[model samples]
Target: MRKLLFEMAYDGSRYHGYQVQQNALSVAEVVQDAVEVVFKKREDIVGCSRTDAGVHASQYFFHMETALQIPPEAAVIALNNCLPGDIAMLSCTEIPPDKAADFHARYSVCWKEYVYKIWNSKVKNPFLQDRAYQVKYPVDAELLDRCAREFIGTHDFRGFCSAGAKPTENYTRTIYRAGVHREGDLIEFRVAGDGFLYNMVRIMVGTLLLAAEGKLKEGDVTRVLASLDREQAGITAPAAGLYLNWVSYTPFGEENPVK
Candidate 1:
C-alpha cells in the first residue's frame, strides 16, 4: 500500500463538519464518496482538523493509504472530476515509504491559522451574506488590533473554550500571532496558534468585538486569562465568519512564521 497526502478546499456551508457523522452530510463523507468513484473502493481518510458548520477552508489537507497505483497527479485530477463544485482538489503527493509511518494529517501539523471576517456596516453586503458575519455597528478595528496582541503567548485557554468539550487535561497553547485588520467594510481577526481548543478562535474574536464596543477593556484580557473563567470571555462569534485560512507543517520561524 502507498500513502498519499492531498490538499483541498471546500465551502462548508452545506456540510455538518469535516468529520463523518451518523446521519448528516460531511466533507469527509463526500470526499470518501468521490474516492470510491475514482478508485473503485472506499478508503478511510484522516483530516487535518475539524471545522464547525458554515465555516470555510481555503486550504485543508487529508491523507489516506491505498493499494491503488494511480500516480499522485492523476489521482488529483480524478478526485477533482468526482468531487462536487463546492469542493476542489488542489494537489496530491505520495509520501516517501520510509517516513510515511510517522506522518499524520493532524498530529504532524505544526500550526494553523484561522480568520474571522466581519462586515462592519449598517448595510450588509449581499455578496457576503453567508461568507461573513454582519455586525451593524461601528467596529474600531484598529483598537481591536492593539488589544489582540495580549493573546500572543502560552496560556491555559480553558476560559476561551466553550463548555462541555470532551475533558482535556492540557489547555495550554501557544499563540504566535493574533491581530485584526480592516479593508473597506471588512474586518478580519486573524490568529495563528500551535493548537486550539473548541471554539477558541471564535471566542477570541468575540472578545475583541467586546473590546471594540467598550464592554471589555484591553486590560481585562489579562484578567480573563488569569481568572480561567469562561464567563469572563465574550460571546462565540458566528461560525459563518470563520475560515481555516491556512495550515503549516514547516518549522515556524521569523523567516517562515505561521501566516
Candidate 2:
C-alpha cells in the first residue's frame, strides 16, 4: 500500500459540509466517490479538519492509502476529472507511509489560519454576495483592529466558543496573530491560532463586529475573556464568511524525534 496526499480546494456553498452524511452531499463524499472510481474499491480518506456547513476551504488536505501505483500528477488529473465542478484537486504527492503517520500523530499542527470576510458597503457586490457577510452599517476598522489584538496569546476562550461543544479540560489556546483589515469595501478578519474550539473564530469576529458597530465597548473583549462564560460573547457570525485558509506543519526536512 502507498499513502497519497491530496491538496484540494472547494467552494462550499452547495454542500452540507466536509463530512459525509445520509441524504446530504458533502465534500468528503464527493472526493471519496472520485477515489472509488479511480481505484474501484472503498477507500478511507482522512481530512485535516471538518469544516461546518456553508464554510469553504482554499487549501484543504486529506490522505488515503491506495494500492494503485499511478504517478501523483496523473492521479491528480484523473481525480479532478471524476470530481464535481465545485471541487478541484490542486496537487497530489506520494509520501512514505511513515510520513503519513507522522502527519497525523499527536495533533502536531503548528497553527491554522482562517479568514472571515464582511461586505461593508451600502450596496452589496453581486460577485461576493455568496462569499461574504453583508453588513451595511458603517464599521470602524480601527476599533475592530484594537478588539482583534485583545485575542492574542493564551486565554480561556470559553466565552468565545459555542455551546454544545464536548467538555474539555483546557479551554486555552495560543493566538499567534489576529488582525482586522479592509480592502475597498470588504472587511477581513484574519486569525492564526494553535487550535480553536467550535465557533470560536466566528464568535470572536462577531464580538469584534459589535465593537465596530458601537454596540460593545472596546474593553468588552477583555471582560469576556475573563468571564469564561459563553453568554457574554456576541452572536455567532454566519458560517458563509468563514474559510479555512491553510494549515501549517513542521518543516518536512526537520529530523524526526522518534526516528
Candidate 3:
C-alpha cells in the first residue's frame, strides 16, 4: 500500500463544505466519487481542514492510502478528468514508506493561512458576486492594516472564534502574520497562524472592518484580545469572502514563496 498526498484548489460556492455529509453535497464527497471511479473502489481520504460552506480554498491537501500503483503525475491528470470544473487537482506525491507512518493530512500541519476578500465600493461587482464580501461603505485599508498588526503574536483566540464551537482544551494560537491590503477596490485581510479556531479568520476580518469604519477605535483590538470576550469582537464576516490560502508543514518555518 502507498499513501498519496494530493493538492487541490476549489470554488466552494456550490458545496456544503469540504467534509462529506449525509443529504448534502460536499467537496470531499465529489472528490471521493472521482477517486472511486479511478481506483475502481472506495479509498477513504483525509483532508487538512473542515472549511465552512461557501468558503473557497486556493490550496488544500488530502491523503489517501491505496493498493493501486500509479505515477503521481498521471494520477493528477486522471483525477482532474473525473472532477468537476470547480475543483482542480494540482499535484500528487507519494509518501515514503518510512515517512508515511508519521505523515498526516491534518495533524502534521505547521501552520495555515487564510484570506478574507472585501469588495469595497458603492457599485456591486458582478464578477465577484460570490467571491468577495461587498461592503458598500468606504473602508480604510491603511488603518485596518495597522490595526491588524495587533493580531500578530501568541494569544488566546477564543474572542475571535464563533460561539458554540466544538469544545477544545486550549484556545491559544500563534499568529505569524496578519495584515490588510487593498488592490483597487478589493480589500484583503491575510492572516497566518499555527492553527485557528472555528470562524477565527472571519471574525478577525470583521473586527478590522469595524476599525476601518471607525466603529472600533485604535487599540480596541488589543483590548478585545486581552479581555478574551467574544462579545467584544466584531461580527463574523460572511463565509463567501474567506479562502484557505496556504498550508505549511515545516516545523516553525515560513511558507514557501508563491504567486
Candidate 1's residue-wise lDDT over 23-131, tens digit each?
9999999999999988889888999999998889999999999999999899999999999998999998888899899889899889899989999999959889778
In candidate 2, position 30 carries an lDDT of 92
Runs in model 2 lying further than 4 Å from the true structure: 105-108, 251-259
> What is candidate 2's CA lDDT for residue 241?
92
Instruction: State which candidate has the highest lDDT.
Output: 3
lDDT per residue for candidate 3 within 200-247, as digits (tens), equals 999998888789778898788999999889888999999999999998
Using TM-score, give the best candidate's number: 3
Q: Which digits, one per residue and each the tens of the lDDT, describe model 2 over residues 1-259?
A: 8877788999899989999999998999999999999877879898878888899998888888888888999988999999989899998877666676666522645677899999998895889855889899889887898889889889989888777788888899889889999888899999988889989999998889879778787778888889998887888999889998977665323344221
- Which residue pairs does candidate 2 place in steric collision? none
Stronger candidate by TM-score (1 vs 3): 3
Q: For each candidate, how many residue pairs have backbone atoms clashing (under 3 Å)?
A: 0, 0, 0
Which run of 10 residues does model 2 get worst, by summed lDDT?
A: 250-259
How does candidate 2 score on lDDT? 0.84
